[model samples]
Target: MEGYKKIIKKLLFFNEPKKMERFVLKETSSKENRTEDSAENNAEKDKQYRARRRKEPGGIRKIDRGTDESSKKEKEIQKEDENKRKDSEVSVYLSHNLTSMKRLYNIPMNGDVVIREFDIILKDRAVGAFIIFFDGMTDRKVINNNILQPLMMLSSLEIKKAEEDIAEYIKKQILPHNQMKEFTSYRKIMDEVNFGGCAIFVDGIAKAFTGDVKGWEHRGVERPNTELVIRGPQEGFTETIRTNTALIRKRLKDEDLICQNFEIGERSNTPCSMMYIKDIANESLVEEVAKRLKSLKVDYLSDSGELEQFIEDSSFLPAPQIIATERPDRVATALTEGRVAVIMHGSPFVLIMPITAEDMVKSPEDNYVRFPYGNLFRLIRYFGIALSLLLPGLYIAITNYHQEMIPTDLLFSIEAAREMVPFPSVIEILIMEIAFELIREAGIRIPGPIGPTLGIIGALILGQAAVAANIVSPVLIIIVAVTGIGSFAAPNFSLAFSFRILRFAFIIIGAMAGFLGITTGLFIYGMWLVSAKSFGVPFLVPFGPKTANAFTDSILRAPIWKQERRPDYLNPKDDRRQAPISRGWMDNGSKGEDEDEQ
Candidate 1:
């Protein structure tokens, strides 16, 4: 141990500047050319070496030779200087080489390492070589048969193949049974390998050869259960972007459909893609969405939901400012409307930005049906929204304060129903509303057959039991149930939740001051709705503030022939969507019959 300590001390002495300078100048310079300090130090060291050599003649004596020679030996001194300079250069090279070698070879005892016993001898000269093994990363047979078996059969000489040759060899022979792509840089290769790729590092080369090993695991395309339609394509967006795009492209066979990609996050390297029609879509909207998505500086991203929050106009907004949809038709519709769709690599849902309140209320199914029925359905949705948001609040306001709006007979009936109830009308309504929301949430969270059963049983058993127990009035329970059903009638889940939250506030306001309070609450809520912006577009556009396209498909759907243009809110440069001549088909048919009779 003592001798080993001495050896380590002597090795580390090379790191000291003064000693290093003395050592280098003596070895790398002639006696005449040597620095004064080097000459003096070499002379002292030589004297000590001579004394030691005299005392112990058999032992090796270390001496500095450059300083002891005469002036007539100037030529020799010059030769020695050149030779020493070369030696010094070699020594410096060796020092750096050894330092790097030590760093790479000195594996920490506490860190991760695997000791693999191989029959073939490893080259003793190389110091930085290491073996990396990943548990469960492959079929052991694939590793042994495809990789290790070939490697074990090769001589020590075969370990040093050039990167390109190794890549070509793997492609031709070793990985012949499987498809693989080769990459040059180790960093790129390592990334691929970590994500189920295979990498081979040659003995001498800095670059590593990598093979693509992307696992065959992806869900098949299925009809979007969430965004169901009666008269459109049954297929929907899948986790695979390729599958999702196919669903869209099946509907639109245009070559102009553009899909542009951006790599986000330094570590996560999350791939985000923007899709739009090159001709029909607005370039600025595409650019804006792309710019915002690219500017995100998150550490990691796993879903479109995370990306949506980052890129939305205001992250703190209670209502979802950007609409997320699973339906390809919905996305295609948004693209036609000049809105941008952001799709992430692994996410099934694509986010549509700058969507208005009317946009949330309307469904893709509306466009597929006849205009009259579509108009009727859309009106029902509008009524659903009004009933969902205002019914409970209105009930509380009318019953508590504005009895004039209620008929004497109805008021008498309500009074009789509330006679047994202990809580006020507002309290009873809130309790039932909250209970319905709980049941709805629980229904969604529980799995399969149990979910629907739990919801039905929970609502029925709980609501009925509460009413019969005089915990809530029958009339209030009816109002809460109607409100819950109305909220469900909304097309978007996020919009429904927003309506639910807003209804609670209306209930509070109605309870506080009756009709005046309800009126004030509606007024304030209207302002908030009007003031809200979905990526700078008025939330209540085409309805609350009203635009010319307001009549096109706002509260009611117009006949396809009547809507000659897309929504004006989209800022579509080519506004016209269909031909004007198509509007007179039925009329022209009737006129043609009369002319034929004449």
Candidate 2:
């Protein structure tokens, strides 16, 4: 071993022969020391690592506790904020102090809020009274002539005798306004003030009087932008809910026509009017609509569109269950047919409920036009609906899977047009369809008189450019144009939108399995429609459940005299719309002659 050590030392250190023995001895000692030191260092490191691992869980626990505390503090702050808001909404009570009433209005801070203070003389006593209104919301002329003029100047002479109750005397004989109400809640009074009305507060009275002086600038009852008919009522619903309800009421003039008022939205407090002929409409249907509207807990309801989305039966379905129309005549007609109309404040569109697929397709003109012409137009619309939904999918299916379905010359032509195109038929169609949709959306959003013109020009230019560039085949352009025209032919805009969405879906399905995929998709769509319900009425009504006297009105428009009964599907209280012998004057005098002969 010593000899081997000497050889290693000579090779590694290259020491002199005399010191080789000493070097070997020193190297052996150093190796033993290194082994001992390495063992000790490793043991120390293991001990330190174990100590850190043991403390890690505790540190994590402390962090979690800190997070929990922070979350708790945040929740507490939110709770306090909510409580403060509720406290601020405390009810208003009439105090003998006029300064307190002014404070209640948050005067000096709110610039638009106006408070006019005056004295009312009753014999020898003068009582302090004030009126509060928003600047732009209320009509200053009406408030001056009707409310303030009588209370401030005319009341002194009118109440020559001593008045024990000032509130009753002013309310009964002083205020000449037609629409005035006494309200006790501060929340309610503020709401009235916000919505174009003035509130009168008396120093000695516990209640405040609210008058309807809503004369803010608004659009007049104009012709409907959508749902235009050739021979029907020209007037449409305005943004004002009262005016809309009045429009419907004017048409019906029935005592049983009920228009119940509801306030929806937490912040908005938008007025919603539910109208129905009490004797004709089903009770359950009306109650269902009310229940849905009441149960909504939203902070703001901007329009009928939002309300419809929230209360609709199914959000996943593409088809709109509620029929939204701006026409007051349509609302009246639906009310007569045992349907409920929900008119939202600040939106011209009125929602007609318990609608069927057939109802969406029918235009108001169908009723006004002669039966033969109406039936012809209705049939054409049906064809348009089919073309819009199925045409593109059929094109994709036939070109991809069943080319034999097309005529020989047409197939050759399609092949020639597509030869220059780089993409497949499916891709080409998708490109064109997407381009068309973009054009449609741009047309709607573009401002001014150029909007409609831009849409037409844009579509024409895009179609021509696409074909010229060979990005899309010429045949596809014609197919897309026809599909777009068909979409326009749909009577209801919502229904048209539904068809547009389904067109894309069918296109995708057709590309996958051709004819088989289209068939499957159609079956599923039909099943969904049949299963869906709009306010308890089946979406595919008069067809799925098969109601009598309803089928004639669905696809075909029967003569007005023959359609003597209301739709059986609605379960209207009154089934007969007219007498069986409605056209008795035109009939032969068989019964009258027999009676005369006897």
Candidate 3:
């Protein structure tokens, strides 16, 4: 009835009509008036402020007492807050600890955090206890058989330490987990729980028990996707950081090998493992790496790639100062050389630091193969890098400006090929380079076997189409193709990327002033790279500074037995890696003595 009356009244004459805003298109005089008034007031205030500043001693106004008091009070409040938070130990009260767990983890909302409450049969009576873990992260069988079953059936386990500390009792006898620890700090227990471990809290105990039962789903050890080698171990580093550390340990069983765990990132609290031979690696270098990592103010570190950027020497440098490899053998090689490897949680790629430019061209496969084969491959890889970086520039320069450099027959053939092309040499090369890069990137982005297939087929079809259209010369297509293949041959992915990016710059300079411009760019680029450092080691170590045994293990691989000493630049504690004349049969008893005498 009220709705009908309202509708009828609206149809007749609405009482709210006067309240409705009626549009009156008039000049906004009030806004103009207000602007004038505000301008005058602001001018007065500015004049007064300037006069006050001039009157003040040394143009400095006295601090406000009220603000000072407020600041002091704020400091006191923060100090009090700190004092309150300093007691981060696990509480003896079960309800308080349970409430804290709920508040911290947002219980009832977070479905992944599983909290199971049960009773443990003590010597005299049953004790209230609970275990907290992520559902998918923990191994159910381990928890059921090892943890819950043992604690619930504690009477059969024969607990003789009734008078002992409950936390120690639980750690020593109650829990049969291989890796168990009693953590008094609740934050540490939560951290362990976050990384796929279960935390056990007893009714009266002030410490929590952490079990290492991480069983998260991850890819198994397989051939490295990027750093694949034909003659070396097929196993690659997985997303699991501990697995990576174990892989390194499996390769190297030296007693001095240390894998120290560090928690980085304020919010993410990522576990980073720094592995090195304590006796071989320079103390200062390890300290420097640790300092940089600890001082990082980032809230989250997702991968080693992101971390490499943060801790690296310079961001503007072209070549990568650090080596990021997925092969455990490579990491082990770096560690054996007195370098440090940082393995970030959830990332397969491990970062090996204090690398040199020569290190960029070397590969793990080199160590596995014979010296001759290694030397041959290293030479070819270097040549390929040079080709990838300089081929396009050289082509542009020779065709555009240095025509006489080419043999007469080749020059004539090149002229014949470009005669049908409407674009200049620069444009022709640029078209082919961009087209090749597009094809390569498309191949990578596309899935599985189809990717490689598309790259091959697409390049052939596109090159043929472009040549038919006379958009690019046939010679240029061959040049671009060769350049791409050279790039793919680079051992380090990061170094290859560095060359790819600089290729464009070389192209531009080569086009502008021919060989002179290219040479100048090279000089500047060399200086830029030479000035860069990787954790105090020069980018061109052993090459620029002429260190000992530089050539033996650098660009050209000497026989494994010949690399007797470590690289001089690292300043490692143990200078001699191996005895001279390392091959026992080759020693001949007197050969090494004779060489030593000489």
Candidate 4:
């Protein structure tokens, strides 16, 4: 050990201090000489690089190469600051406004951006002005008749007030458009133009007028294709954000309903509306939702689905933390329950957040049906959820490890069916699952009525073929078919997807350790769910934390009159949604007293 230490010191140059010092000094001297030569070469290279940059359109010159990078960064920062300040507000000079607008919008190069120059012939004098908007986005008839014709030809009298701004005069008197909004900031004007609205900038005025002439073609409100109901309002949400908001407003006529607009995605600048009841929704919950949206730094959010992913609590968890639905009625119902609704432009699906697991299992048809009928449907859905999540794993465990659990005749039948199968139970189940998924995907990819027809025919033919070929046993095919049907019964699409993924995990676990492994997975999943939160509200709400109204409203639904209070887990400002005597027609003496006692 002593000899080894000594040898290590020698190799590491620790023992011979003088010799090591001398060698280090020699190396340092050589490095200094090499650095001096490299410095000269670097300076020459910098000069050549600067010369090349100077030839480019608008490059700044630096006096010293040593401060080149720092100077460049400082200049960039100053230039950006100046531009922002200059373009922050509208300018009086029409030429300057024209130049800024052109540069900001990449005019002439942008095929759709139209700059229609016109003169608003006032009685005093003609004022130079221009309107900018995307060609396909703006309605030509509205622009030509409501705006251009009135502004150019209908100015019979001049403004008597000398102090009144021209932009204000034009907004109040000249234009016949209803949705004209005056903006002092160029950023606001630009945003209006991007959203299919047009901006009117006039000379001798330091303000701009924006009109909402958004006329881009969109789908009409139709029966919800994905979530069809037999006994409810058939109108689903459309891609246009304004239309979706209108549908909600038509249902909810309360003055306290507030809809605040937010812009997400730095480059995309997609418009989003966050809505909640002013008196019912908790202030902190509203702030949390806004904070999450404002903090998202993504460049593009294409749909509400994408926005859901950004604001959800946990990304890796199979269960979705937010609910996305295509029906406008559902959005209205959620808002009434003190939930926040996030509606994004260009997507039919609207997102409702801070929801419990029980919310996902509910159907829109529940309210229209009788209380007993609704309760029956809820039970059926819960049973379907159980089958979708655990049926395959249970089947695998029973046949492979818990044979005694099965009856004698059924067990013998299962055995006879699997006699010709080459793969084990696990592999056999996986093959059918994958094949079913492929069929479902292929059906979706094919468009029109053909999609559903193909799905139905394909499933039947595929299952029959697999059974006949002995690739899978008849009993396994029945299990897979039942599982697929149960997954379809899930009310929310996201919840269905989560169950589909967990089904596979459960299958693998049960295959390895039979029923015990399956039980362990469920235990861990339940624990995780108990701890998970949606914007600070417990995910498993009444079940996990044992909150109020768990049984009355969650697992089952009481009569409409019996549900007098909102879900207390939300901590809404006004938890009492209705008075004890909700059924005004019924005599309140006995029923109201009973409710009060509870």
Candidate 5:
């Protein structure tokens, strides 16, 4: 230790051109440690100590001035004093050398030892102190009040002796009986304690004791705003990550369920939790998800949507690569099917990774309803989505480009309707489409009751007035209204938006080349749909690949018991979700009473 100290001292300050002078001073016997008994014997120790000074005092010396000794000796003493002061500052409880206290709790009065300082106070009639160590990561209240007050107000004088006394006092006087464990390590206390934990430091002890002090504002669980359901669990995930995880866990109680957490964002330190189930989930899938999450280097993430875009597999595709669901049961079901779920702090929605095109069409309510009814609704929704996308384009094409395909009576009616209007069919259709879109947009912006009413009134009044004034045909109004209704039938709003944009492209093609243009537009649209993928799975799975089981619930309705296996799109380990012979039907078990009597 002595040799190491000498080396440190020499390396820090004593190295210089005058090696001979430094050696003469340090090697000399004047600077050796002295015994306490010998120090008492020499009454004029200070004067004797200064007699060997190198730079002799010229005149009367001031109290602060050092006696003319070797400059190295004076500097060495000054350095030692400064170091001693720094050590004192760092040690929190100098007088109390408590054995239980960890090294981290030490708050030195000395500059080098003191890690941080915090003000102590009382709150809700409990003694506490605020720990201000981490700049932004830790909550301030836990440090100041939870930790400091308990240590300061302890009745015992000897801190080492008061270990039990302090712990007991905190349980009895300061904290609730259940909170005793909170007055331990600062790390565990802060994390486990319901309230933010506080830490207090004594002078000599290197460790601080933390107590629970976490209580803050939070929102109550409510129905999901975006992913609304007509028939399903009403509860939605809150901003709290713990609450969100609990919501999922409540629905899924399997032992294999795993939730790994990480703190990202350099300054925000936002917590992100990844949820998956073992055995059922693919190991590679979980590893890939964790790797991607670890790779994220952002300052802050406000929502899961922001993270989704950053970590998604494909950026150019309009379809969402991740399935963001607000429903907890949905997340649990996904986990059961061996899919990974990513949940972000301060966001209600949980993101299901490696989603397929099939995910956009599926709903949480699908499992809730009977198979046949559910399948019917699914088919209807698919039809509605198609109508929403192609209705206007098809109408334009049939009326303007492929008039021969139209029925004779329908064509005459359409021509009669158009005769009253001066604008060309394309211009007339475009005008009505734009106006309807504006009305629909306006209705969404205003308050609910008024917004819908205004939209309805505007559409009806404008369409009627336009027809009366010969501005637009009544047939065009009908086409636009049906198109709007079809768009609303889509399950996913993001997918619906993609289809809406695609509608315009079809409309332009139809006007340019008539039947040839419409045929080419359909072909190109089909190709685009086939090419799109969500995650690694094909977006147009059941339709493009033509899998037998994939179409069990696709395009047409299938009976519930017959649809036993899970969709193959997800590559589930347990494909058969239902047992064979689940359908209940028994016919020949008993004889009739009359027949038996005879």
Candidate 6:
């Protein structure tokens, strides 16, 4: 062994340390010398190469080389040219000549852009004028009767002063349209014209007058198809934002309910209205909402849903931070609660923000019904939420890991139902759940009257066939049916969808680790809820943080008189909704007694 060790040490150079060190030092010194010589040779070669290049005819020296400088100057010139092109692309101011206006509108190229040029006969002489409007957008009757008839036929006869300014005289005495504005920017004129309005441009004037002649077809206010209620007002919001705001105004007559209009979407130019009670809502909350809305850089926001997605606090969260409803009463209620409602044009749904879990779970009918029944239904909804989210998971856990916990008779029946089924409980549940979801989606996409019927028939036939074919067990069918019912019971559509997504997650976890996995999932879900914020308000507000006053109205509908304060979580400016003793007349009963005695 010692001889073998000595041989290994010799091979590894561990024996004779001084000799090894000497060898390494000599090699390093030689390498350094070689490197120095190579560097010197490279320097001399570079100097010679430069000298040769300089001696060649028409050869440029290093300092005189202009390739990089020329390229940089070329880039700068291109950048400046691009900036100039962009500036030139900006819309020009309204011109004095009718031909210029026609060219600006691209009259010959765009068939929809109509430029009706006519002679404006004044007392002194006839002046050239034109009206530009988009076809099918503007009301032709208003243009002809209000603008044209007054300017062409009436102005010539009415104007007596021969020296009066033609544009000013026509605007003051001729145009009778209530909504008219004088604008100098052609961009503003185009926007107005695009929005179903007409712009009147004069022959020698640099300014144009625009009138609101929007009379395009829109669906009228109808009963809400999604959020149906029996006791509350049946009127729902229409696609037209003006009509929707009017519906809210009719319900909420309070002058303090302020509706601020904003035009978003560079391409779509979709109108949005932010409604809040000025004196009651928190100023910061209002400002924050407005700031976020203004910060959006999207070009086309088609609906409130799209707007909500753009401005919502978090995109990854399954739960919707805003509540969208077509019911005007719902918007009115939200406004009274110190929450902001965003009403978008072309969408019937209005988005209510800074929403909590309780808000999503509570139906609009909760306020209309008696408090006792409302509270009862609210409790039932809570149960439904739990059932929808956790029931499938619990079933999988119990059958797989806790079968002994089941009662004997029920266990026997469950076993008998599963006898012919070939798949496991989790697989069976997943099959039924996926099948039901497909049916639901098909029902929504399928046209008219047949939708609901098809959903029912599809579910019934599918469930029956699955059981008979021993694909999914009968007990799994019952579980899936109950889960579907529970999902439908959620008041908010977005909240329902979130629960649907979490339901699958719970099922997978439960199948892996049984009840332990389910408990862990619930804990993580609760933690996520506690941490999530909706527009600076906690998602689990008044519950995790424990607001005493707000707790009474959450998950339980208190009497209308008892709910005398808005949600404290909102930090409302005006907290008190009503007097402490709203029924003071009952206490002061002498007036009725005196009348009876008399």
TM per prediction? 0.69, 0.84, 0.84, 0.86, 0.67, 0.83
Find the 10 residues in a row with the least total lDDT in model 5.
55-64
Deviating ranges (above 4 Å) for candidate 4: 1-88, 158-165, 588-598
Per-prediction tally of clashes: 0, 0, 0, 0, 50, 0
Give the alpha carbon lDDT tens digit for every residue of 1-598 in model 1: 9999999999888754565434453354455665566778767765654554322121312334344433233445445543333232111222332232233324343143222333323343322322233434444556566655654554243436544544355346544336455444334543554444455444433444444434336788788877788898786677766667777777667787788877777667776778887877666777788788878887788888888878877665456788888898888877766677788878999898888877788888998999888888888888988899989988988888889999999999989988999988877888888888889889999988999999988988998899789898778878888888888789888888788888998899888897788789778767877888776678888776677765777777677778777777667666777777675777799899999999
**lDDT at 521, model 6:** 94
Give lDDT for model 6. Answer: 0.82
- For residue 238, model 3's alpha carbon misses the true position, in angstroms, by 0.7
lDDT of 6 by residue, 347-375 (tens): 99999989987889989999899999898
Backbone clash total for model 2 is 0
Better of 1 and 4 by TM-score: 4
lDDT of 3 by residue, 1-598 (tens): 9999989988999565467688996533243443344778757755554443322222223322331232333345444544333336777878767876775677999999999999877656777888999999989999999998988886334444642466666777778889988787767888899889998888888778899988889999989989888898999999898889999999999999998889998779999999899999999999999999889998998899999999999998989999999999989988988999999989999999999898888888998999999889988898899999999999999888999999999999989988888888888788788888898899999997999999989999999999899888888888998899899889999989999999999999999999999999999998887888889988887877778766788767778888898888999999788887677876676787898899
Give a tens-digit lDDT track for model 4, residues 1-598: 9999988888988554455434453232233343444778767756665564432112323233343343444356446644574457787889878987887777788888999899988777788999999998989999999999988888767765642556667777889899999888888888888889999988888888899998888899988878999999999999988899999999999899999999999779999999999999999999999999999999998998899988999998888899889888898888888899999998999889898888889898988899999999999999999998999999999988999999999999999999999999999999999998888889999988998899899989988998899999999999999999999999988899899899999999999999999999999999888888999999998888889855677878888888888888888898887888876767657788889999
lDDT of 5 at 461: 95
Q: How accurate is candidate 4 locally (lDDT)?
A: 0.86
Off by over 4 Å in 6: 1-104, 157-164, 590-598
Top candidate on TM-score is: 4
- Candidate 2: give the clashing pairs: none
The alpha-carbon deviation from the true structure for residue 306 of candidate 2, after best TM-score superposition, in angstroms, is 0.2
